[model samples]
Target: MHELAIMESALDLALGQARQGGAGRVRVIRLRIGTLSGVVPEALQFAFEALAPGTLAEGAQLAIEQVPACFWCAACAREFTSADLIAQCPDCRELSGDLRTGRELELTSLEID
Candidate 1:
């Protein structure tokens, strides 16, 4: 799955950061994944377990933070969390709106030693 590739890339970045900081080993890796990012947390966790052998993050703990999809509803004149792709504004039933947050797949922090 694509999650394997993504997890591998995350590991690479985490290892790089640990090396840069002179960390002997990575203690933890924190990730922020938005609901609309299309990433499966379970798959990513499995991929990390499979691919982290002998790396600086071999025994690292992975913390996944789930972010909800938020949108700005012009009709409603407010922001709200989207429940689905066809996210109509709950208050005003608006069909079109601007996405404020979501679709985020980022490595927010790394705890190393």
Candidate 2:
């Protein structure tokens, strides 16, 4: 799965940062995953478990924060959480709006020892 590659890259980045900070090992990796990011959390978790063997992040906890989709409804003149991509304004049923968030897959922080 592509999540394996993604986890590999994330692990590499976290390991690099930990090494630069003179960390002996990583304790946790905090990730922010948006609902619209198209990333499967379970797949990512399995990939991390399989790939972290013998690495600095071995046994490290992967903490994922789920971000909901937020958008601005032009017709309603308000920002609200979207149920899906085609979500219209709940009040006015208008399809036009600006997506504000929920398209991110960011590695926020790493807790290393």
**Per-candidate RMSD vs. true structure?**
1.1, 1.2
* Tens-digit lDDT string for candidate 2 (1-113): 88888888888898899999999999999998889888899999999999888988999999999999998887668988885886777788888447788887888999999
Return the clash pairs for model 2, or none: none
- Model 1 per-residue lDDT tens digits across residues 1-113: 99999998988888889999999899999999989899999999999999888988888899999999898888668888985755788788887547777888999999999
Give the clashing residue pairs of candidate 1, or none. Answer: none
Provide the clash count, candidate 2.
0
Model 1 TM-score relative to the real fold: 0.94
Choose the strongest candidate by lDDT.
1
Candidate 2, superposed: residue stretches over 4 Å from native: none
Q: Which stretches of candidate 1 lie over 4 Å from their true place?
A: none
